[model samples]
Target: MRAITLSEYGGPDDLEPAEFPEPKVAPGEVLVRVRAAGVNPVDWKIAEGLLDALLEVRFPLVPGWDVAGVVEQVGLDVEEFSVGDEVMGYIRKDTVQLGAYAERVAASVRLLARRPAALSWEQAAGLPLAGLTAYQSLERVGVAAGETVLVHAAAGGVGSLGVQLAVARGARVIGTASERNHGFLRELGAEPVAYGDGLAERVRELAPEGVDAALDFVGGGVVDLSQELLRRRDRVASIADPEAVAKGGHYVWVRPDSVDLTVLADLADAGRLDVPVDRVLPLADAAEAWRYSRTGRARGKVVLTVD
Candidate 1:
């Protein structure tokens, strides 16, 4: 199997495709033939040494978090799926160091979910990590039907789904993106706002009564604006900027939940959710993907097509 690995954490130049031994499946796990893998900021964060203290990694660790693939073999205890099942999952937050960057990967059965018939492999691969993050973040904010929710970075990976999921839940959704993605956000059923100086004022202008809930995907003192936009402090949540999250408002850390992913997939299959793929590149072009992801401007998830 070939994968992007780095013995030392650094820039994109450190990333290289190298042959590695195929992973063995443990009990209650399944070996999947990788088809497409999602590239996330977390992947590049690990490669750049930001998560060195938190994540225990062996030498030359793989850097993918989301994968959509076909099950090649199933472990003895894996009863939910067979050898031929098509699956997708958030593989990074599942295992300690191993991830889904290679031609094949062994994933826990509990974390795996069947891909929706209506979605392509690229679209399915984008769902697990970002989808779960958005769902859980909205949950944390107590987004209820008939409420108004403002999502920062609405054109982003998690923000894009946050918009759709909020809309599906009957919330009047307002999303913040660049001017270019305003139409894209509108297509996802959100009233879009361009992020800039006085962004909160702009949202307030759009809704004079104020927003009921606010989810900040983009960090850096945005909570001050979020707090101003929403009346209740408890109704605010931030996925990034944990330090500011506690001081400014509620903190949300992205965690893996199989049930949540299943519900999200159901929403997707029901046409209530949108899984947008920004671009799909070969696995070896991970360096370029990492560079683009670092900009934090991708319309949705960027995926790597695997052989």
Candidate 2:
């Protein structure tokens, strides 16, 4: 199997194409033939060694978590799926290595869900990580129908999905982005606000009474801004800021849950959710994918087509 591997963590340039033996299937796990993989900021961050303190990494690491693929074999005790099942998952393990970047990967059934029929492999690959982050964060803040929810970086991967999911729950969405992305947010059923010095003021203008909840995907002191514009401090959450907990708001780290991914797939199949693939690069170009994500300008998801 060919994969993007690194013996040491540093920059995207450190990623190189290499061959490794096929991973052995374990009990309760399934081997997936990789068709597409999602590239996320965390992928690059892990490559740069930012998560060394939290996630133990072995050398010659294969870095990626989001995958949409076909099951070639199933380990013992797995009953939910079998060979030939088209599946997708957030395949994050306790330690980081032998991941979705390869031609094949062994993923636990606990993290696997059938891919949504409405989405292409690339789109399905893009949904797991970002979609789960947005879904879990909004759920933590308890976004409900008729409420006005504020989303920071509304047009980015996670934020855009958050807007759609909130809207699906009947919440009105107010999203922050650049002037260029305002129209994009509107398409996702959100009222757009340009993020800057007056971000709080702009959100206030949209929901004069105050936003019912806020999800901060951007971490540059935006939790404070969410507090100022939210009706209550408890109705705020942040995936990008741990300081949110200190400020009486929830700090969200997306969990790998088959149930949650199934719900997202249902939403997509029902036309209530969608993932935009901003760009699709071949698996060998993983380094370039990291560079593009580093620019912080992709309006949607970046995917690696494993051909």
Candidate 3:
């Protein structure tokens, strides 16, 4: 199978096109024929050895986790799905090696969910990690209906999803983004505020009484910024910064949950949630995809289409 392989941690230039033996399907796993794969900032970070201490890494690694594809085979004891089913998942295993940036991926059944019927392959591929991060953060912070929520980096991959999910929960959302993305946030049902210099003052103007909860997707002191406009400091969360815990806010690291993925799929199928794809490239161009992700300017998700 064709794949993007990295024998050593470095930069985008280290990612190369290569051929590899098919991943072995273990019990409780399914082999998926990859159609599209999501490219995330973490993918590049992992390539640069940024997560060396946290995750076990093997040589000649395939770097990716988000995938939307068709099941070609099911392993033993996997009764929930069968061959020929379409599925998507965040395939973050305990170790790093074989992954979604290939023609096929062997994903554990526990991580699999049926693809949302309304989403295209690219959209479904981009949904798992970012969607879970946003959803889980809001759940951890106890965001509730009739409350107001502030989402930093509101136009970003995770932040955009966070804004929409909060809105779907009946929470009034105030999102912080650049001036260029304000209109985009409004379309997502969020009141947009520019994110710099006076972010706290801007959010205060929008919700003078203060916000009920806040989610920081861009962690350059955003947790602190959120605190300035939050009525309850404990109702703040950050996915990017562990310092959030020091500030009495929750620090979230999204886990792969089949149930949570199903809920996100349901939202997409119900027309209540959608992922915007900023760009789609062929799998062979995975290196370029990493470069683009490092720019930090994508308004939505970036995806890789596999042939």
Candidate 4:
């Protein structure tokens, strides 16, 4: 297998393309022949040792979690999928090595779901992590139909999906982004609000009474802003801010669940959800993808395609 590896904790420059042995399939896992891998900030953050205290990372690490591919082999006791099944998953394991940025990866069935036929491999790869984050966050806050929900960073990967999913639930969505991305947010069924100054006021302008729920994806004190506009202070969830819990709001850490992933897949198949892909680079260009992700300019998801 060919993979992008990091000899130690560093930046994009540390990533190197090298040959590695194929991973052995464990019981309850399946080996996926990688078609595409989604580029996420956490991939690079993990590369830079940002999650050092939290995760156990080994040397010569492969740093990707989001994958869309075909199942090549099934491990013992696996009955959900078989060879040739198309699947997408957030394949984060307890350890940080042998990931989706390779020719193939072995992931637990618990993390895998049948890929939505409506999405291309690139789009499918982009959905698992960001979609799950948005879905789980919205779920945590209990967003319901006819409610007005505010989503921070609405044009970014997770936020864009958040807007669409909220809209699918029949919730009126108010999303925060730059002026350049306001139109994009509108396409996702959100009333767009420019972030950074008087954000709360702008949201209030749209919903005079106050929003029913809020999702903070950008995390620079947006939880406080959300709390101010939320009818109930606790009806807010933050993926970027851990302080949300202290502020009487919820802080969400996305977990891999086959059921949740399948719901997202169903939404896509029903034409209620769409994955917005900003860029697609070859697997060998993983470093370049990380650079683009670091710039924070991508409108949606960035993906690496494997031939």
State every prediction's TM-score relative to the real structure: 0.97, 0.99, 0.99, 0.99
Q: Per-residue lDDT of 1-307 in model 4, one digit per residue for the tens?
A: 8999999999999899999889999999999999999999999999998999999999889989999999999999999999999999999999999899999999999999999999999999999999999999999999999999999999999999999999999999999899999899988999998998888888888999999999999888989888888899999999999899999999998999999999999999999999999999999999999999999889999999999
- Cα displacement (angstroms), candidate 3, residue 301, comes to 0.2
The numbered model that scores best in lDDT is 4
lDDT of 3 by residue, 71-110 (tens): 9999988998999999999999998999899999999999
Candidate 2 TM-score versus the reference = 0.99
lDDT tens digits, residues 208-289, model 1?
9999999889987777788887878668888886765556568876776678888988888898887998988999898899
lDDT of 2: 0.93
Error of 4 at 168 (Å): 0.5
Off by over 4 Å in 4: none
For model 2, state the Cα shift of residue 149 in Å.
0.2
Worst 10 residues of 1 by lDDT: 91-100
* TM-score, cand. 3: 0.99
Checking candidate 2 for backbone clashes, the offending pairs are none
RMSD of each: 1.3, 0.6, 0.6, 0.6
Global Cα lDDT for candidate 4: 0.95
Quote the lDDT for 50 in model 1.
86
